[model samples]
Target: MNLNESDMKVQEPRLWSSDGWTARVVKNEDDDGWAVAMTPDGASEPALVGPWTMGRDKKNPKPLDQSAFLTLVKTAREFVRRSEQQLHAALHQSIAVTVGTARVTVCLDITPDEDNPSATLSARDEGDDLLAQVRVPPSFKLSRSSAVAWAEGGFVKPR
Candidate 1:
């Protein structure tokens, strides 16, 4: 069966919903006040969790409202964005170095895996020609000096 966007049912607001995000009020483990957790779809955990305001009785947590839900969506989206940026910075690093008469870009890309972790250090010329590539340990550090040294030393694996 093929399902289109129009055929999809509109998600109802609840303590937990399956739309792009779900806002749920849960008992705070560290304190007596309740906390609201905003979880993005397909994520294992909530992107944002914070203290929730009390309801009229001053006991039960306030119900989720349109205003609060919109704010939570913005906050959760930003959280996901920042997380992706940090992960990208950790995985891919690059440096520019002069190799003889030509300037080359050296990149260190790390592929993390549970069974086996690996990294590739590659150099490319001005026109994007592959100059050299070497399989290195994931923990190998890449710097301008290191890249220049490797290129000058005949592109051998650096110690």
Candidate 2:
């Protein structure tokens, strides 16, 4: 298929799009400054948006260039990665404790649903074999004392 020049990568003064990312300079809503938004291809919203450099006149935004676009891409990718990591950490938690003379690791995994959010509390022995697993409320708090208490209580489903 023939692609027109406009359909190809754009490198305008205020807009740049290439390599699965687009950088657009827009007016800041909170102030007179300019802001740049970095959006990945196929995404409706920008993953990163921050202040942009002002032009020599200090009235207009600085032109978008190759160097600036690349920097924005890198920063935006890192920002997305960090956000994913934080969400993963919040959804899954683990702690290790001793049950009798053997070591065990307890984990809590949360499944977020609009209608029925839920969580699972599971334990694994030192050999990584599943000791027990039970459904729990999403609000259940996992702590060292709680884990130890559960283990000592014979791994029964907590009340």
List residue ranges in candidate 2 displaced over 4 A. 2-7
lDDT of each: 0.83, 0.93
Q: After superposition on all CA atoms, what RMSD does each candidate show versus the true structure?
A: 3.2, 2.3
1-159 per-residue lDDT for model 2 (tens digits): 997443569989999998888899999999999999998888889999999999999999999999989989999999999999998988899999998897989999999999999999999998999999999999999999989999989999988
Report backbone clashes per prediction.
Answer: 0, 0
All candidates' TM-scores? Answer: 0.81, 0.92
Highest lDDT against the true fold, candidate:
2
The number of clashing residue pairs in model 2 is 0
Error of 1 at 50 (Å): 2.8
Q: Write the per-residue lDDT of candidate 1 for residues 48-81, one digit (tens) a residue.
A: 8988888888877877777777787788789889
lDDT of 1: 0.83
